[model samples]
Target: MTVRVLIADDSSLQRSGWRMVLESQPDLEIVGEAGDGARVLAIVRREPTDVVLMDVHMPRVNGLVASERILTDAAVRELGAPPRIVLATALELDDHLAEAARAGVFAVIHKDTDPESLFDIVRAAASAVDGRAD
Candidate 1:
């Protein structure tokens, strides 16, 4: 099954870069895109996507806050398996990193992660979504 993905980043280049990497995998599908954290919720609401690659720094909400909101939302929380989120951060801020764990993130992927690792991370996250992982 294809894992539906949403990309949220302030930079167009970063978004496009991730799209290219993720879409290259036949098992991953690019379902939606957003350039600001302010727009992420709406996109996810409309798309019913299974995964989100969110940037930690953005114009409005930022990835940490967005991830918290998604995890707490009754709609997502009530699901047997909710959309897995892997925040993309330029800097691995310890605060945001710890917060990500508390926010129930499936993973935190670096913005500069190598293509092979990115693919591996996404696949592992999908396994988490399916209750086959920790």
Candidate 2:
């Protein structure tokens, strides 16, 4: 099955870079793109997304807060298996990682992660949407 992915990042360059990498995978499809957490939710609401690649640092709302909202929202929860969240961060902060885990993020991807690893992460996260992977 093809994985529908939403990209949430403030930097256009970063988002475009990720789009290129993810697009190279035959089973992955980019469903939406958002510049901030607020936009992320908006796009997810309108699109059928299986996974979200969210940047931790955003303008309107941070990824952690967005993740918490997405996880706890009743309407969003009703959408079958909730979309898997893979947080993207430029810094490797333990506190952020802890908060991400508590927020129910599926995975944490460093900005410097190799393209192959990014693809692998998203592939695994796609499976997570069905509760098939941990």
Candidate 3:
């Protein structure tokens, strides 16, 4: 099955880069892209996404806040299983790790993570959603 994915980041370049990398994978599908957390929320509410790669800092709402909201919102929950969220940041993740876990984030990775690792992370997150490693 194709894993539907959403890419959320404030930078257009970052979003584009991730899109390019993710699109190259046959099992991964880029459902949408968002420049901010609010857009992420909106898209997930309307689209069926298996994984979300979200940036830590964004205008309007941050990744942690968006993760919390998406995991808890009744409308979102009604859409079936909530998407697994993976928070990515340029800064140290130590401070945000606890809070991100509390918000039901699937994982956290640094912005400099290798492309292969990023692909693995996203696939793992998608697997967690449906109990299928593929």
lDDT: which candidate is best?
3
Q: Per-prediction TM-score, please?
A: 0.88, 0.93, 0.96
Clashing pairs in 3: none
lDDT value for model 3: 0.93
* lDDT scores in order: 0.81, 0.87, 0.93
Off by over 4 Å in 1: 75-80, 93-95, 130-134
RMSD per candidate (Å) reads 2.3, 1.7, 1.0
lDDT (Cα, tens digit) per residue for candidate 1, span 1-134: 77888888999999999999999989999988998866887676556677888888888798878888876676655544567888988786564778889888888777889999988887777767757552
TM-score of 1: 0.88
Better of 2 and 3 by TM-score: 3
Ranking the candidates on lDDT from highest down gives: 3, 2, 1
Which window of ten consecutive residues has the lowest lDDT sum in model 3? 125-134
**Candidate 2's residue-wise lDDT over 1-134, tens digit each?**
89989999999999999999899988899998999998888777667789999999999899999998887776676666678899988897665888999999988878889999988888898887867753
lDDT-best of 2 and 3? 3
Per-residue lDDT of model 3, residues 2-112, tens digit only: 889999999999999999999999999999999999999999999999999999999999999999999888877778889999999999989789999999999999988
